[model samples]
Target: MSTHVDDADRLARVTLSRTIEPGDLRVTGLVSELGAGKVLGYLEAAGEVENHWGFALAQELGRVDPAQVLVQAAEQGIRFIVPGDPEWPTQLGALSNTGALHDRGGEPVGLWVRGAHDLHQFAGNAVAVVGSRAATSYGTEQASELSRDLATMGHTVISGLAYGVDQAAHRGALLAGGPTIAVLPGGVDRPYPAAHAQLLDAIAERGLVVSEAPPGVGPTRTRFLARNRIVAGLAEGTVVVEGAVRSGAINTAHWTTNLHRPLMGVPGPVSSAASAGVNQLIRLGQASMVTTAQDVITDVMTHAARAATGAEQLDESFVPDPVRYPQSAGPGPAAGISASRR
Candidate 1:
């Protein structure tokens, strides 16, 4: 989709947003199934000839004040880009054919995107780095260094913005002077965990924080699972830094794999409990091992560059030794890596 659209399409998208329920699969399916121009038609066919369904659905969802929600969405400078809209990401559209598309748990009829940068900029070239919330210092350092390296190479880093690996990725990308996107499990206005409020604010200001849920929706167990699909969908590949045996990060890895995106894992020592899952992924052939950002990016970016430019093959490289951080590195308050593990 192009980054420009007609005023009518934008208004229709806003109207659709007001109508859909938070995390309602039926509503999201209807939007995806019918696309933009036909959404009103489908709603009318369901009942009501005078566009009553749009306003009525808003009231039924108890969105504080139906009219107020629309007003607030507009006041915040948020714009909704539906599937057929020019700004709708082409990469996201590809998901529809794969049956692995997340579509933000069928809540968002259109993304309520804000910030100076266009949302499609993320689709330009993105990769997600996710791992356990209880990450070790080694996992955190790998995530941070990988994020920074990717950002420095003009790639947008994507993550969940949780503690541990997620936080490290965001800080690393920010430190590298690059934009990043945090796809939240709740509303854009609602940052989960509450403790990350300052960090989230910084991301929304300098980068982008996105969600499929409506403005007032809070995070939930189900919402967290749904958000992972989005992280996988938005990026060309996903890298699992460190996770526990049954971690949510594994869900994102599976989603990426199912969607035919490359799945990479940052391998850690077998002795580290935090890296056991990552090692398992490598062992099972579900993901390739990546010790550095270039290892992962080579598969996603360099091959494409080579294809486009007809360049000769290049030798593989590792991250600089001086910058390589270990899991045993003593943690300080600023680092955010778990101190207990240190």
Candidate 2:
């Protein structure tokens, strides 16, 4: 059974979800200090403030009614899980400590989830596999095989529902008869990229479809970037199969590393443009190289056990060394064209 939340608190968080963008530190600080209900009340009462953020909050409050948003969400089979709810994934609280990544940091006020599985349980042992939307055949195959092997080992696979690598990873988990979670940039009710609607539906049937946005919202470039933090936050580790230097997968990898979570990258052919980001990550000591499911599981579980036993703090030497780029290959200009254009 689901845990009960107070009507006012639930309404406040739902209202905030619609009004404030995810990871807004200013709003998060206000809510943390005054509570969501009081923050909403303050917003409702404020006339105008000189600050841009304050002005925006007041304007947003004028147009939204929490009660109506709740009604719409319920009608669409979506439930809002707040910070203390039984279904909330507590691991996400780690975001609160991410000081400089403020644009993509701060704990979400709540999540809009559509699925049967418990969110906390579903995320407890998950590993995220993300990569290029324009992945090569080798990248797609590697993502699928790794996802399948991870699933067979009882790990839940998590990914964005984009084309190429993300799609292949989700499919591999399904084919292995394992649960998979899809984190969306838009509302849980609306699938972005329209083409992946069926794939998103299939994932929700077995696992979950999650979003920080409310039911009627659509994706934006900022929202897509912000969404990567959640993908990294929910998983025990993150793997980038293939991407350019500035792709979304690399963004997710940065979040994983910032949170001190296990970050891994799979190598592709040295000649492949798609492998550039992963190769760069490994070369710069930003991530470790992982070729197989066992490699990922070993790293994840070792870190988990270390954290559990406080060995991570007591002895730094016990932790695995960062993987280095192979010295055998002669260095040239890094594999792909500059990602600034992308």
> Which candidate's lDDT is highest?
2
**Candidate 1 lDDT over residue span 1-342, tens digit each:** 354556555565555555554445555566567664466555545554445545556344333343556578768755555665555566665445444333344434566565557667666678899998999898888889889877876678999989999999999999989899988887777877689988888888888887766666788877787788778878878999998768889988877887777899988888988888889999999998776666666566543444445656532332222222222112111222222212
TM-score of each: 0.76, 0.88
Q: What lDDT does model 2 reach?
A: 0.82
Q: lDDT for model 1, on a 0 to 1 scale? A: 0.70
lDDT of 2 by residue, 135-196 (tens): 99988998998898778767899999999999999999999998999999989988877999
Question: What lDDT does the true structure give each of the candidates?
Answer: 0.70, 0.82
Deviation in Å, model 1, residue 141 alpha carbon = 1.2
What candidate 1 gets wrong by more than 4 Å, as runs, is: 1-27, 36-68, 100-108, 302-342
Candidate 2 collision pairs: none
RMSD of each: 8.0, 7.8
Please state the error at residue 302 of candidate 1 in Å.
5.7
Displacement of residue 77 (Cα, Å) in model 2 is: 1.3
